[model samples]
Target: MPRARPPPPPPRRMEAPPLPGFSEEQFRAACRELDQPAPAAGGPWQLLVESMGVRIYRLYDEQSGLYEYKIFGGLADCPPKLCADVYMDLDFRKQWDQYVKELHEKIYDGEKVIYWEVKYPFPLSNRDYVYIRECREMDVDGRKIWVVLAQSVSVPQCPEKPGIVRVKNYKQSLAIESDGKTGSKVYMYYFDNPGGMIPSWLVNWAAKSGVPTFLKDMQKACCNYSKNT
Candidate 1:
């Protein structure tokens, strides 16, 4: 008798059905927020921490009862284009960002969508997000800038998993440009409501510690990107 055929490889995960299209108008509106100036001190924006040349601020959202964060800084020794590329590289992100449990992009109806699951500490359920994102290059007064925008989106195809909390309210914007040297000038705004009973103190602590840590990790990743890719 012929030797038993080798077992078939595991089937690939099925791609979700077509998602709703994110419009150019929506994308442009989001980009405008990234272009706006940072909120001045002594306003609703309260400064959280300033370290390593990065300033982080938080503003309370009355409607959501959550905090939104803004960051202004530069990534030293990392060029603008390289910095942006490293940020948008999802495959590489999985390798560097320890919090990223799962991240990938899928195209549906000619639009690309991102799915991400983040690992939370023990006893806390993981949080997952499905969002639409776009990136653009712009020239303002002869200065080149890169802008990336993302917001949560709902679709029937990506239903919430049982053990994970679905984050329905989330938005992120980033603008990067040359720092007049070999570094990148960066501005970032982020907000997300991880749907659960998580305490406010824990959330605030995570943001305060997490943002700086993430930027440092990204900077290190950027330094190694060319070799890795």
Candidate 2:
């Protein structure tokens, strides 16, 4: 009998492509922030709202003259893995996030980048952002933690558009883990300065109302995620 080919060398296992600009240090820093206690009241951090099992707070940055927000909450019916999946699902985002006028991913200089254009109320121009983001899961003190972090980056190919305002300064960090039962606990830090002269009132409204609305929408989306996918 012809020599039987040794079982074809075990098929090579494929590995996930590395994130182009991923930084372990940055991811760890975000995790640390998530572990910190909530900012004290009567200080720079002002409580915005506490309802529906969520708390939102904002702090002013003198350098940027903008507000940065910190939010934490529990999702009663959503698991950590499901929450992360729903958040990262760009295709599904378009179907659910009404404010997403345009969103997509592209490659530039061998790095994957995300571009998002958000709708502003009438009379105000739309805003767009180009940023790089990454996510990872880890075990901390026997508890599983999931983190997603993002920051705006300058990309030569993606320049300012005529009508849309470009958000030059943006950063976001999100951490999710078990709620000790059947749900997930969440934490987030976010800031962005939409270029141009936007009224302070409008900005405040967007922040205060937008955050809770987004969480509610996300929860609803999570409920439908399995069926939709």
Candidate 3:
């Protein structure tokens, strides 16, 4: 008989935080990027659209052939808590998040580390990310808001898995604000070098079709959480 595998060890804390405030800085930068005007001189970013109240933007990185994208979630009926819970509940998230092929959480270096695999079209390699995430509540402009941020972290304990292309660098920020009733303001940013021979058409599709679909799905799930949970 084969030997049974032992349980994984518990997470450990670092003597000092690494890349302190990296996520916050990234989040701030994302906020600024969102307000900036679209380039007129024909730089990388050349696409913008608004559909179903969601403003979508895309940027093509000549250095990497990868595009950085952002989606502004217009006010939905989802409460801040419910909207935030859509992604926090990893177990339930996989069921509704159509883009995620696999996702699970593990503690590493005293932080919530997530293992995520994103589905890709056939003939293209799937993308994976190991990121440290944190959720915090803060007062923003005299109103309470919840901010959840995650960014790829390089750690020896979390190595790139086989059969998945690891995203060397990626940053995501989600800010949720409630109006004390049942309305929320949501914002998201995603940038990654998927590290594969992904064509321009696929990249375009991701910004044009993929982002809005994902956000709409999340909104629908949030609206249904009360019934399910």
Q: Which numbered prediction scores highest in lDDT against the true structure? A: 2
Off by over 4 Å in 2: 1-22, 41-43
**Which of candidates 1 and 2 is the stronger one according to lDDT?**
2
lDDT of each: 0.83, 0.86, 0.73
Model 2: lowest-lDDT 10 consecutive positions = 13-22
The CA root-mean-square deviation of candidate 3, after full C-alpha superposition on the true structure, stands at 8.8
Residues 45-158 of candidate 1 have per-residue lDDT tens digits of 988888787788899899988889988878999998999899999999999999999999986556777999999998889999999987887666676888787888886666
What's each prediction's clash count?
A: 0, 0, 0
Identify the runs in model 3 with alpha carbons over 4 angstroms from their true place: 1-47, 60-62, 179-181
Ranking by lDDT: 2, 1, 3
What's the candidate order when arranged by decreasing TM-score? Answer: 2, 1, 3
User: Which 10-residue window in model 3 sums to the lowest lDDT?
Assistant: 30-39
Which candidate, 2 or 3, would have the higher lDDT against the true structure?
2
Residue-level lDDT of model 3, residues 52-107, one tens digit each, is 77777677677876667767665568877677777688887877877789888887
